[model samples]
Target: MPGIYLGAILFSLVGMMLIDLKYSLALRVAPVRTTLTVLISTSFFLAWDLVGIATGVFVKGDSPLFVGVTLAPHLPLEEVFFLLFLSYLAVVMVAVFERRAAARRRHGGGRSATHRAPLEESA
Candidate 1:
């Protein structure tokens, strides 16, 4: 159970990547942009975590699921992987929404049948 959490995270990351690849979203669409976005976001979150740790707001609790590794005093090695997954998830989600919106626009200004006005009855 020590590495279960890490395994789960990595599994989920792989699934997300498969989805992105299948749909040519995010990473498949723009590798450099997606990488940069994830890196920036991960870096920002890491900084936030550091600040929280400094302020005593963030603390690492003992867990059997952890890999027993720490990057810093309160930061775990798995934290980086989790942060990367989170950032990548965000990027993939945005790409999905953008693709859907673009498809909607191409089809007709993004108005679905539900949004269309009802047709008039014949005389």
Candidate 2:
């Protein structure tokens, strides 16, 4: 169980990548944008983690699932991978939802009751 958590995160990341590939949601649609989004988000979260660690709010808990590698005093190697996966997943999910919304709108299926013709004003 030393690296179970890392392995799980990687596995989940692979699944998400497969989904992205199938739908061309992120990389296929816009590789540069996706890369920038993931990198920026990961960097931002890593900065937040560093702040938390400095403030003693993010101590490394005892977990056998870790790979026994620390980037800094409290940051683990798995944390970087997890952050990457988190950022990638977020970008992919946003792309997926955006495409879905676009399709719905194109099909005229996105209109709400308020936007409709109000049943011809009750005849």
Candidate 3:
């Protein structure tokens, strides 16, 4: 239904925004780098999707549940947006995990520093 498609779009946008905020605030990523990474990843996914559609690996069916113009069998412009949203979400999840791991390493290293005595004894 149109309602479902609309809801999907809204949810995707919100999710992407949250992910962006998390990366920006927690990872301290620059806006330019974030934007570039997302842009590049999205482009790659889109190209892959397009190829899949062309090769019949992915086919669209007649469904009123989708938004945008359908150029081929079940293929709609809106699918690109959906893919990009999902891809960005995946990247954000990876970034969050990496950030957590790095934090843990730093914290553990700091604690270990106190346990190890100084190499050079006081004269």
Candidate lDDT (C-alpha), each = 0.92, 0.92, 0.69
What is the TM-score ranking, best to worst? 1, 2, 3
- Candidate 3 overall lDDT versus native: 0.69
Residues 38-99 of candidate 1: C-alpha lDDT, one tens digit per residue: 99999999999999999999999999999999999999988999999999999999998998
TM-score winner between 1 and 3, please give it: 1
The TM-score of predicted model 2 comes to: 0.87
- Model 3 earns a TM-score of 0.70
RMSD values, in order shown: 3.6, 3.3, 7.3
Write the residue-wise lDDT of candidate 2 on 1-123 in tens digits. 799999999999999989999989999888999999999999999999999999999999889889999999999999999999999999998987898999998988877666767675565
- Extract clashing residue pairs from model 3: 60-74
The deviation in Å at residue 89 for candidate 2 is: 0.8
Best by lDDT: 2
lDDT of 1 at 56: 99
Write down the worst ten-residue block by lDDT for model 1: 114-123
Instruction: Give the alpha carbon lDDT tens digit for every residue of 58-114 in model 3.
Output: 887666776657755556767766766766677677777777788988887444544
